[model samples]
Structure formats: C-alpha cells, structure tokens
Target: MSLVESPLLSIRNFYKKYGDGCLFCTTDSESENPYMDGNRCLECGTVWACRNLNFDLYQGEILGIVGESGSGKSTLVKSLFFNEEPTYGEMYLASYRDGEQNVFDCSHQTKRYLQNHELGMVDQNPYHGLRMDYSSGGNIAEKLIAADYSHVGQMVERAEELLEKVEIPVARMNEPPRKFSGGMQQRVQISKALANRPPLLLLGEITTGLDLSVQARVLDLIRTIQQELKVSMIVISHDLGVIRMLTDRTLVLNQGRIVENGLTDQIMEDPQHAYTQLLVHSLL
Candidate 1:
C-alpha cells in the first residue's frame, strides 16, 4: 500500500507501570485500572508519567511532543517504536492501506510492517544509535544491511551520498564516529536513519546535548531532510525552543497526559494550560 493512502499512526490509552503498587500489597495483576491502583498514588504514581494518553500523526508532518523532565515524553516514543511495551492501552502505527483508520485496537499486520520498514528512530545521544568504532560509512552501511540490502557496493555508494547530503565531509567518510565531533556524529546518525527513507522518524531530543550553534545546524539539517524526503517526524524533547523550530504543531505533555495541542506558533504564543504557559516561559 502506498504511504499516501495509509492510516498513518495512532495511540490510545497507553500505560505502563512496574512493581507492586503497594509495599505490602502484592497482587499479580495491576489491571484493575491501568493508570493507577486502588489506594491512590503508588511509587510509580509518584513519577506520574503518561496517564490515559491519546495522540496521532499523519504522513509528511512533524509532530512535536514536549514536556518537563519525567513527563513520559521518552516513554511514549519508546512504546510507539517497540523498544518498550505498553502495560495497557493500544497503539496502531503504519496502517496506511485503504479503508483503515489506523486504530490502536486493530490487528498486528500493520504494526509489523511499520516495525520492519516504515519507522526510524534517533536518540538523545547519537553515539547510542551508531557504531562509534566503525567508519562513518560503516555506521550507515550497517543499517542498509539490516534492511536487507543485497548489493553491498550500492549500499556503500548510497551511504557516501547520504553522508554528503548531511554535510559530512566525503573525505572523512572512512573515519570512525569516535573521531568526529558531537555534531558530525549526529549527522551520521541522521544519514543512517534516513538511508531507507522511513515514513516516520522518531527523534528523542536529537539536539539536546549539542552546543547551541551545533544544535541549530543539526536541527536545520533535519528540517531540510524532512521536507526533501516528505517523511513524517515525531520529535520528543523537553526543550520548547527545539520543538518550536522543528514542528508545525505541538502537543504539550504534562505528566504523560496532553495538556494542550495546537499549532506550534499559537501554542507557544498563547498557551492555554498552566503547564504549557510555564513551558513557554522557560523558553523565553
């Protein structure tokens, strides 16, 4: 099925909790209520991550999810990408066939296709997503291998072009990621993730650890890549500044629930929720 006709992606009522809710009360199932237990705030409750979260993303648009530390931003991204399982709730992604709604309550066929072909992920630390010891070309080529590219030479050639596209010097393509600066390493990560041109790219604070100048450059590169590739992007970050630059629309997450959702400019200029207001101020 073509991506244009696909249902895109959706998440509904996703939840995750660990350990017994009570120190003394040991129960096998925490399913009585996925959000919380009977007696009130448990240890996990103290963290108070995502509660009854619902969100969606369509093709060719960037959706920014922003919140304070521990707001479940990272967890939500992880759950969508299959890095972590949701304790409860449903997530349906990559359901881009005709006559489908992309509901989380649907069958697993679409999800499997997404996991294998339609999704790409970038983490806060680019090194974590790449092989530091291998040459820049190696880091990118490995991904093509995983994606089942049979032509090794073609993969290397493609990797070289991607490196050039991300502004990495072609001369240094053979050098290991460890020798490159933080910004350069990130470019490699982006190139590797984009090699197959996945429909959805999940970016987890991809710019946070870099310096201000590097951050701006990487972010701009990402924007250019997104538009040129026409891929959907989901950027999860605590930095409102980064979100404002990358996304056309934003979802303000507070304690795992969306407090506000609107166009990025409008939401940043006139935030409706207290949490959104606070976040906007922090950016200022």
Candidate 2:
C-alpha cells in the first residue's frame, strides 16, 4: 500500500453540479465570484455537488471520505460509481487500459463494462442498492449474471458463500431482503456488491440507520472482507467514528471540496482545517 506505487484509481479535476452554470458560476471563477455562496451560485441557484475533487485510491487500501451533510462525500462516491455524471473530470483506473485513458471520456458501453466487472456499490439506503422483492440469493445472482455468470448452480453456490461471509444464514438465502432486518438488508447488499469479486468497492453510508450493535457487526464485516479479499474501497460516511474504524487514509470534505487529506489517525489527532478541527472536536 505504498503511496509511491501507481494508484488503483486516480481522479483529477472532478466536478459535478446540479444545474447549468451561469456567467457568475463557472468552475474556474467560482472562488472569486462575489455571487457565490459556498458551493452554490447565488446568481443562478446552481449547486456544485462536487468541486475539483482530486485523489488517489491505492491498491488494497480503505479510503474514508467523511463530512457532514452537503459536504459532497456521497456525491463523490455517486460520481465514482457512475450514478451521477460529472460536469467535467478525468478518472483513470489502473485496472483499465493500464491507466492510460480517462474513463469519463470513455463510451457509455465502456462505463457499463467497468460497472459490471470492475466496480461494486453499496448505497446508504437498501432500497437504492437492492431489489427488495428479489430473494437475497437472487439479488447476488443478478450481479453475477451481469458479470457473465451463466450456471445457476454455481451462482447459487457463490451467493451462499457470499451470504455466509457477511454472516447471513444460508437457509435465508431464498428470503427477500424486504423480509430481513435493517442489518440483514445491509449484509445482503454487501454480499451482492461482492458477488463479482470486484477490485474496487464504493460504500456510501452503509452503516447508517442501524442499531449500535448492528453497526458494530457490519463494520467488523467490512474490515474482515477488506483483509480477506484485499479489495480497495471508498467508504463514505458522516460519522468520524465509522471512518476511524474502517479507513487507512481519510478525506475531509466541506462545501463540495476536499479541505483535508491524510492518514486517518493523523487527521483525528491533529486536524489542520478549521472544519476538520470542528469535526474532530465533535468526535471527542
């Protein structure tokens, strides 16, 4: 996990906005514009959800993105997962084309290829990540199918194995996620995300809305999976406690920009940015 090695994923000048820009709200001039409020353009009401995000996710590393609401933590991950299109950016994946091409500029089919084979996403809401009506095993089979899995027996076996990895009972594999508890639903989602054994996983607030005990179990599951599979992950959460438990490096975002980036322990010990300092103090 040396930083000197080439990154698994590299993002540069990434930006995502909700509305069309006005004369006073261009990305290059927004900082100097008098009509701008934080990440929003006061003149046009355009909200820049992510602004010039630049970061590298190294191989087999867990990178945490922590920020309060509206800090673009979720937006960054959504953009990476291709749930939201970026206004402009270059994303280079070492696993894709030897990191020579910008994925953003690639074709739609190529993006779909990346999504199916190279990436996995677990959204904060189970509704967003899972087909609640589908059986837990079916949900995982859906992902495996997308990755070209054809044998029903093998897919079922894989599903069972993944479910067990997240501590879900094999007997409940045929039950729909709608019938499961919140923690169980999240576990199923995690299993589905890992169905393809993707190298990069995007987890957006996966532990939110669960009980404290359930949260602990889910967090432990994530750690175990990372260690066992060596899958690089981008973990997005508003809670620093969750970040501290799961991340090796951390990014502190504010108003759509990354205000701080460093080792998780260092960021917790001595946060440099004012907003990050407030976050650390609040954690204490």
Top of the candidates by lDDT: 2
Give lDDT tens digits, candidate 2, residues 1-284.
75579999999999989998888888485446688888899988999888888999999999999999998888788878887789999999999999999999888899989999999999999999999998999999999999999999999999999998998899999999999999999999999999999999999999999999999999999999999999999999999999999999999999988999999999999999999999999985
Query: Which residue segments of model 1 deviate by more than 4 Å?
Result: 1-7, 22-40, 43-48, 95-113
Residue pairs in steric clash, candidate 2? Answer: none
Please write out the lDDT profile of model 1 over residues 118-213, one tens digit for every residue.
Answer: 678887887678889998898888777766788978988999899989898899999999999988888899888888778888899988779999
- Which pairs clash (backbone N, Cα, C closer than 3 Å) in model 1? 6-96, 7-95, 7-96, 50-256
